[model samples]
Target chain A: MAAMTHTETDGKQGLLPAIPAGLRAAAPVTILLVLGFLAPLLTVAAYAFATPRSFDVFRSFTLANFSAIFDPSNTVWMSFAWSLAYASATVVLLAAIAYPIAYGLNRMFGKWSGLVGVLFVFPLFVSENVRLYGWVLFFIKNGVLDGGLKWLGFSGGPEVLYTPGIILFGMIYVYLPFMLFPMSLGIAMIPRDLVDAARDLGASRFMIWREVELPLAMPGILIGMLLTFVLGAGAIAEAKILGGQSVIPIAQDIEVAFTYAQNWPLGSALALLLVAIVSGLALYVLSKLDLDRILGKR
Target chain B: MMKISRRNMMQMMGAAAFAGPLASATRAFAAREKELNILCWEGYNSAEVLDPFRSSQGARVKAESLTNDPTMINRLRAGETRIWDLINVNNPWARKVMAPAGLIKPLPRAEFEPYFDTMLPEFKAPYRWAMSDDGKDLLGMAQRFGPYSFVVNTDKISKATAEEQGWDLFNDASLAGKYGVQESDDWNVFNIFLVAGINPFKEHTEEEFKAFAETAEKIFKGAKMVGDMASLNQALVSGEIDLYMTGGTYSVSPARADGYPNLRAITPLKGPIDGKGGISWIEITSTVNNPELSPLAIEFLKYVQDPEVSHTVAFAEGTFNPVSQMGDPKCFELFTKEELEAIQWDTLEEDMARSAEYDILPDYDKALELMTAAKRLRG
Candidate 1:
């Protein structure tokens, strides 16, 4: 009878404290983030400190990999510089190219906007390498452009494939949609009455765009720029398939270290450095933006 | 409706419970005895090569192809030895790497030695790469070899000039921006050493290293493009490039077979390594050191030695190559005129004579770093 009374008292107190509903709801995504994102990142971090050229991650720790990268004799820094330069150029070029198309989608497409949007996204379903190779077939000597031109009594197509310029061109072509959609959403977010109000208040076309439209659409534009820059910085295929390795991006260097060199520590260090740069830039931009407002939260 | 007794229903359930595991165990035992798994380079995994063997042996055969030899070797190192029954890679790995690592088991000498006698003369009995370094064990079987050097359009740079000029052709200032470089790191390093008049196989002094670096930088900077075999071949066909470095009959055979006979892989008449200017890669297929070693492994090895299978392997996957079995008259007769021309059969012997066997370089890592640095500096 005493033992039964003790069990009753414990039951009344509850075996465990109740979990908050919000925490319960977030359990799945939180677990996913920990397992998928955090675990791999931690593994990479552990590898970065491993002995150079060795797979002794966690068992051994040394700064040798970082030292090798920091060594003055290493020209891997040039690859990093090239990758960053290309990424920056890609962002600027895509901004220029996607803006007009994005504007037309918002202001002109009407109810057909979704269909036009699908056309832009259609190429994404095809493999990136296949589409790039199609470009290769089109641009290559005696290829479609050259053959067609020659048949029409023209000299031939200009030599454009397999150059640094073409690498940039390929990146812009590939990342255009990443820039375009976000920018379209940003432009669409602007209230039409505000621009009209600015115009009625005796503002010039440029002034209205500057004071009302640009600031309002800045969030989407910022997201687009961030997306393109991050993706461009990690670009590898464009340099290989299109540029003909005219330039070795940092990603290729990291790949070589992992594969041909069999230096997992060095590869991890290189990857970590790239991640730091891209993540630092991303976090800085993301911190400044009102994500709640951008995402349509009340 | 008639009602069944509970006891009868209980008996049926008890019998099913007892027999289910027995059936599964029997199936598993049968599957284990008949299963053969292969890890190899691309050609050996093709349906043309595997399907007939599967049907003949009544076995369940599976294969995975990887492009890089080191990557496949590393997979074995990472505990995949238990999963694979057979492994086929370039020749040196068997003698130089895999044998030392114990990733593969030696074949029976009496059974496998006769196959070598039927192979090309270069792969005659006691072939160095197909044996242990101590010459006590038969390591593997050799097939699919060619002299890899550089290729050119015979129309622009005649084959004679290419052979005569050799590595010096790349040094000529006029050829800058005219030739493409295949992005094969190992072959590129070999070619760069040849260009620098250095033997890549030997350990190099600091001065030789400096020379290698300079040659690498110059080669990368001078080339019109650096790309894969398909891209380089396309560029060659399109007239965008006159020649490409690190090519062979293996890389150019498809184009040649497509009626572009002017495109030819050139083996230089002279080189730094004992006067051989070209590197040839021979593949060796060996039994993996799996705990459950399949009996079918040796049977399939012998099966591929047959003339029709050899011909099928040579032409598998759209890339044409000459197999060592072609040295046998029976295998030679299997080739059609077009196929013979495709593999550049006319020059195979002479090219092989002029080429050094591909081997592991003592300073490969250093050379790769220098090569990678040169590539980056070019960027």
Candidate 2:
């Protein structure tokens, strides 16, 4: 059989047939995937080192883009510090609330949890503009909640959109679904006997949860919270339209460079730097937590 | 009094039918062998404008409005060759972004002809004009101009004096969070120069820079940062900001026409910041594939030059400016030619004479850094 296959391969001369068979069929799809996914990013990564030399000759091996972003004028240090804090807060709040809802529905309702799932996921179908606008209208002085508060005798028009508290509210609102989905899926993996086993041993509810539920559910909580945290970290439209410039996000820096400033090299550098830093943090977190084992598969 | 006449109204509805057909009947239009795909905004070539051009030239134009020039430039940079025959480009975006990206057709002066003469020395802005330097026929014709000035909500602003200007909206006792100005370097650089009382056309002293910085500090201290017309308009209409500065009327006209009752505008007594005379510059340029179709496009381009359609676009669609000197001063089919001229072209020279030139394009990167620094400093 091996000799027969070798004779056939020798006849073919190491090339696939011209028609859509074997290598010919897969060649186009592989080329397309590589071109679509890798080429643009490679071009941008190349720009991270782009610098003018003599007569339009560019020497593109420097780390200058990364250094420039960290320059004092970029104010990236302060902005990113604040962004991390904001994201962390959003993750905590979203996870704290989303866990109960996701876990309860998954446990109590079984297949009917799908209806709750639809309700949770439905807002994703709406445009970001619609979501932001709804929030903007909700937080203004004469807005729905404000009017209700006024009717209930809240006297002040307290610049709700401009406040940090309101920003926290918005970040949570946008990322809760991210938090909920991952968390619910995580909780589903836990065996029912673990909780029942804890309870039957005469442990109180708090003791059972602290020992059994929290540890098992941790991976989901971590992954879910991480997704929310990352999304919140780079959040732009929410802070831009609704945050009222009282607090400008670092993403706005990217906007100014790309759009109004038209300085793409700088923008690309800044953005790529952000990617590097964020990815570094993510890897750090994942390694520390051993997410591969937690997820059980890659 | 509705400002739309019957015959023109019928033509408009007819044009709408043309639009719906064009989207579905792409292959049939391809058979016309005369279809031009233009990437532009809603105001640049509304059906009212393109339909007449199509009927006359047998060349149909399909315009797709983009978010901004830089975004369009990126699309073009990605080798968007056959997608667009004409596009709207910003002054600096065309210079720093588009032209540098090698996304152009290298148009020369000989082809532009009479419209070539129409570009004044100043109107021949930085980057697009560079295309002409390559010794080839030019690609695009400028459609409308953008004028940057202060606009006041009539309900809030009672004065229009020069002293009332000087970035004092940041200091106005009644308006603190209620007034807005743009956050970009274009606005920041000009506002600083103006508040420092330096003329951009002339040199600046060390004292001027300090004064500029000081007043900028003052203005930004209490001022709200505005991103664009959408943000400014929302605030302006919702009574968030009663007065705003450093904006173009290209996006402001219809918002005013909406008859907020509180809506009003002023050129400001001293003139626009640094007298750079920012205006919404709507122009058209043909891509390489459509170079042969210039006759048809130029014909359509000439139609756009007509004060009639220009006025309708500016006054109704919020893309201000389609100006011509020879047209009847009061006889636009849409806006009286007088109204059209007012919105389209006058602010450039008037601002140049009254205020310092606003040089926001150069040192743009530095300006961004400064603006962010200023924002941080404010915090």
Candidate 3:
């Protein structure tokens, strides 16, 4: 039986053909995962336990770096909570805004969809920093928004720049397209015949969408949520530039440790903690949704 | 006959595609014997100053700007001393920290004393703070010194009014949301102490700490925006905010050079201690402890003291500041009347007299914690 199994696996192939096709196809990505992702993570983990003052990992190990995270004086807990909330809000907001736009673009623009798709991605051509600053020009007091409002005879407008709302708006603006494209692709892949069949069965358009289209788009929504959440959680620029010091996220605290405080070990510890939290959350959600079969389809 | 597999063939094609640029990049990193690596502030490495030195000495100059003294000192302590040939930092760090750490070596007094002869009388004598504590070694050469204080838009508020109000201007409840704060945590602590009527140069009592924290919270709350030096300048120019806290010639000069002379930095007339309301920073150029590069470092110091080089360093790319070599006739000639006025040179002497030298605050860790907590409360 063993001989038969081996023969079947190796039949009509070269020397390495006994290796499964799936493993062979995944070899490049596995190499990248080890070298690019795992190596840096191990380095950061090693540094997190280094002697704080000297920054020498081999000389000694200490927990002072990790202990600093709980020090109320640092207010790291507050910053962490702020970052989680900021990222959660951004993901929810982007998903809500992108779905309709993506759906309309995919379904309504049948012939011109290609051109309109380019327009959707046009903002990506400009860098994130430039795009954030563009928002700054529009949102700053007495800026373009205020000028236009005055021209429209509005008076005594509220200041928008340096507010928390503007920061979230900036994050949503930057991440909306990331959510849109994948959702659009997922929707387009839904068979036209399935929706037509639902309509022919005396189901209304709303029922067709609610029962069939939304379920089919789950993979794209999940992918979009993960991407937007990670990027938004790690973002430092939107808060620093648009929201000012009023919005001090965990990234800013990590930056202060490395730059101002000159404490690399503490920064590493905080960064690793943040990574653990984000990755754990993502894994939990993926497990619940069985993303393997869904996102794996693409 | 031998044949290459498809994977091997593609690998070879990829290698061939990247070979040229990879080879050139490797060649580009070849070490130069005469190359000088400088870690200093923005103005020290401007093209106008570095190009001349590079041309004259036939050397390559690689420079990196430092954000703060502690970070740079920590980098050197972590074994970067071998890589950097020169260090330019505020005098206190050079005298108290770097020299003591043996991260930098003493300068040759004979070679540098001549340049000191041409400097302002205050800098003519090797200041005690610019030397090793034992006073046997000249630890650094002074240049690019200025009174660093908050700046205001002269169009909205008169310089006289700002100077008279001094630190009190920021504490006013009526001024809430009328001004901005520069996002420098350490500097903000010093400013808070100044506003709270406590001298930061000494260790603070519990009461003083509480007062400083309260003052910081109030000031932060009053600010409409807290931004970096660049954004603070923009806010002032664009009328987003009328003034910014913790600004100086370093923040306003670039705007002035760009034709916005209305921005003005104010040195207050009175304070809690000795009636001095602002801090003055004197940047010192010192040689890193690299024996091989010490000669080039000293030569660069001499080159930098030249009038043209001094002017260039003073008005370097990001911001313009007044240099210590301003006493030199040639250096004085480099600044046009408008340029000097933009720097507020007319009141330069008075501003200097009214300012206290920038000193290392005692127990900075505690101050940093308290200030950070205060900032967190601003949310």
Candidate 4:
């Protein structure tokens, strides 16, 4: 009877195709992605198509939200433009600022690099809002900088708070670490031997850097840019806390629609558009890269 | 050790999973009887306010605070009515939205009406906002209320000039870049309308909207800064801005409490809204129409009406404001001289009298869009 049971089990196992080991390993993460990420996105998409200002998600469908957003009279698009512009600015400025710092950490810091890295990361322990408020206190009239200047027998510090320039400054300040760490990793990945070999071949420092270092570091640099850009695009706190809502970012507009306006469909539509733009850019950039090589799998 | 087959193990796991939810359901059902859930604005949810009620009732009391009235009301509209036993929001929502939609239960008139007797004269029995539109049902209890308008550093812009100039302060081209605007959307919209010489509550013509759009643009353009209360107060203290629109007692009280008494909230002496130049907000705490409403909800309603609780609610969350019960000597005496000064108790009566009740704007969405556009344009 045991032999017969074993024979039946073998028959059943043979009839059912074997699952791929990779698929079996991926099951948990795939399920998590479906439940956690895809479900909320699908809900947002469904709501994006619902009636304007109505919570008839999944039950109704309309393009009124899209129409309103696209309408020339509607200036909501300016918010999106401002967000992308700020994000672009943040990426550019952070790239310039972080590249030098990242280089110094990798090339100049020696064994103290880890401690220096920790120093760079320390500010993140405090809430971004608190730190920005600290900046507010520093720059505010009769605040630290201004008061110090006054004590030193000078006019108070410049009115730097609540300007468009300060919004960009705050984004650059808040997202500096995001740009720095990835960039440091990228710079570290550049083999010292390759640089030495190029020097031995009489390659000038600039030539070696431009030809070898930049290309090799592209992956990490791109990752940092993407990270900072995405973060900056979605930034609301810097604008609120530091920029003083001088610029209404798209996120705040979306928030207002959902909160004060109680128009979920409109908010969802705005959110979906932002997600599409960001994810589209991300996908395009990701598609051009060899992630396995970047991740050291090769 | 006992050996179990793989099949038996799977069966046992499945049974546990099925039983887990059933046990949780049983526990949740049991908890409902001993739980009182409240949804309110910030002050009512403060530990200082809720801890006493929790101990007195010997029940689990939880409260959530949302800054926006429409957002909180929308939670009920989204079926959170089943979750909350009490909902406190600005006055109009109870009469204009919640009671009409049956999201909130009307209070027992005989039991709740007398609480108003001790309240401020403005909130006297048959208080319009606390009652249903038909004036038959008492929908909620009035509590924290104050005139909300622009605030100024009295040292930079004297209170007398500010009150007299009123909303025209924002319109003055010479004062451009000298003042700031707070990021309170509804209040900004109202102030923008007032600056444009249009009544915000009434329906408007396209021409009026055009004027509103222009005024919003000008205001955003002229502002030295735009921020929340704290930032505005800081700016005011530092002289970064002489004054800011969309501020009042609720926004300036903390600064006043901190000894920067020069940061004063000014209600304009006269302008639109039936010649009342300021907008005042009165919070109405009502019973939510939950399927299994806790009896403790009514007890809490009565408890907060007590002078001591009323005083606590007024000063809760670090932002000082006046309560309707201050008309009662017991409640009035609870406030110290400093506290009274912080809340600008001296001007409270006159300001309220000169202020129009904050109301639902007929064209708020359009105004919000225009305002948002103007802010972006400034950026």
Q: How do all models score by TM-score? A: 0.91, 0.77, 0.88, 0.95
Candidate 2 chain A weakest lDDT stretch, 10 residues: A51-60
> Clash number for model 2?
14
Choose the strongest candidate by TM-score. 4
Considering every candidate listed, which one attains the maximal lDDT? 1
lDDT of 2 at A5: 68
Report the TM-score of the second chain of model 4 against its true counterpart: 0.95
Assess chain B of each prediction and give its TM-score: 0.92, 0.64, 0.90, 0.95
What would the per-residue lDDT of candidate 2 be over residues A20-89, giving only the tens digit for each residue? 5666659889899989998878666676566511111144466665777766655766666667788888
Provide the DockQ value for model 3.
0.51
**What ranges in model 3 sit over 4 Å off?**
A1-36, A51-54, A71-74, A151-153, A289-298, B1-32, B55-58, B291-295
lDDT for residue B91 in candidate 3, whole number 0-100: 75
Tens-place lDDT digits, model 3, residues B1-379: 6699896698789898899788866664444356788999887877887998888888889899977877888878878988889998887998888988898998888877778878877887667666888888998899888888899999998999999999988887777887988877777778889989888888889999999888878887778888888878878877888888888887887787778888988999899757689888889878898755635677788888889888888777887888879988988999998779778888888888889988888778778767776767666
User: Candidates ranked by DockQ, best first?
Assistant: 4, 1, 3, 2
DockQ of each: 0.61, 0.18, 0.51, 0.76
Report candidate 2's interface RMSD in Å: 3.8
TM-score of 3: 0.88
How many residue pairs collide in each prediction?
A: 0, 14, 0, 0
lDDT of 2: 0.60
* DockQ, structure candidate 2: 0.18
Per-residue lDDT of model 4, residues A1-298, tens digit only: 6579799978876776586658867999999988997899899999999999888888998999999999998888888999999999999999999999999999998999889999989999999999999999998888999999999999878888887788899999999999999888888899999999999999998999899898888889999999998898899998888787778899999998898777899999999999999989989988988798689887
